[model samples]
Target: YLASEPGGRHVRLRKKGKTASLTFKVGRGAHREEREVKLSPKQFAALWPGTAGRRLRKLRYEIPWRNLMIEIDVYRGKHSGLVVAEVEFPDLATCREFKPPRWFGREVTSQNRYSNVRLANE
Candidate 1:
């Protein structure tokens, strides 16, 4: 639950099934850029000791919705029963103009509590 220093980068070590990766994120909100590097389990294990952050587990489903692809996440473990859907746009204009389907519940893009990092900590 450490905060990212002002203008500093945010990094995370993630393991999904047999795949492991180290992700570096810069910027904030909807404008952030992320870069990921694949890692071996042994490498991940070595890095895990020094990494500071919560781990999250979820099942992701990608479905085509209109002109955009919607990513639905079904959380597991402590956060079970939580389902969230997200859509990425090419630009802010497209994002602002996009609309959600009936199945999509309330929008939480601006809600910090629903963010993956926050959810991991919760």
Candidate 2:
């Protein structure tokens, strides 16, 4: 997903193995949806086993404002000090519309900066 802030939001079509998803802001912890995936860890891995990287897990906090939702990730482990807030948009054109808070760090979408798959092996 692309990263962005207030003026609007950055957007990207995420590319994954056989599964790609589009997720965006809703309410608060507010957005809602439904889905059914049938796969145990074993089965899941067998289908699309992921990569290895530094493992990091955190509590995600979503704060809503106007038409945007700021997502904060409080990470644990090697990347512990790192906290990132992201706003997903519909396209790059729209991303230019917003202003991100100063606290936000570099945009890391393509880097897989927060992928747990990479985390597990780091």
Candidate 3:
């Protein structure tokens, strides 16, 4: 799944400690649960130095499906305007494929720019 928007803003509810995370969309949509991994700034730099011509941005959308919420991401830089959606499935093949909304660009699931860890630095 994929989508593109003019833009949207969200307030992040955050907590810090081991495995830091933030929550968004409050009562609606799946909670934006994120856990920070243990990685050095040097290690993170090696992965994404903000000059790789790719950046990651994510949007958590509310879905009216079976206990599900959609996570859509828009890539920046060389991969600008690209969109992809990730929906958790009970089975690997449980997901069905369909054409994205007209606003969406292309699907780049195989692209390396979709990773959030890389996006954090880029």
**Best candidate according to lDDT:** 1
lDDT ranking from best to worst? 1, 2, 3
User: What TM-score goes with each of the models?
Assistant: 0.78, 0.46, 0.36
- The whole-model C-alpha lDDT of candidate 3 against the native structure comes to 0.40
- Lowest-lDDT window of 10 residues in candidate 2? 25-34
35-105 in candidate 3: lDDT tens per residue? Answer: 33454545444544332333344444545454555556555554566566766445334444433456545
TM-score of candidate 2 against the unseen true structure: 0.46
Candidate 1 per-residue C-alpha lDDT over 1-122 given as tens digits, one digit per residue, 9 for 90 to 100: 12344473667787878998888878666667778899998998888866454767899999987779999999998899999998877788987788788888987877777877777666
Error of 1 at 50 (Å): 4.3
lDDT of 2: 0.49
lDDT of 2 by residue, 15-111 (tens): 2345543334222211223232444545545433232232245667888855778888777777687776777665556566777777778766545
Q: Which residue pairs of candidate 3 clash? A: none
Off by over 4 Å in 3: 1-59, 65-68, 73-84, 96-104
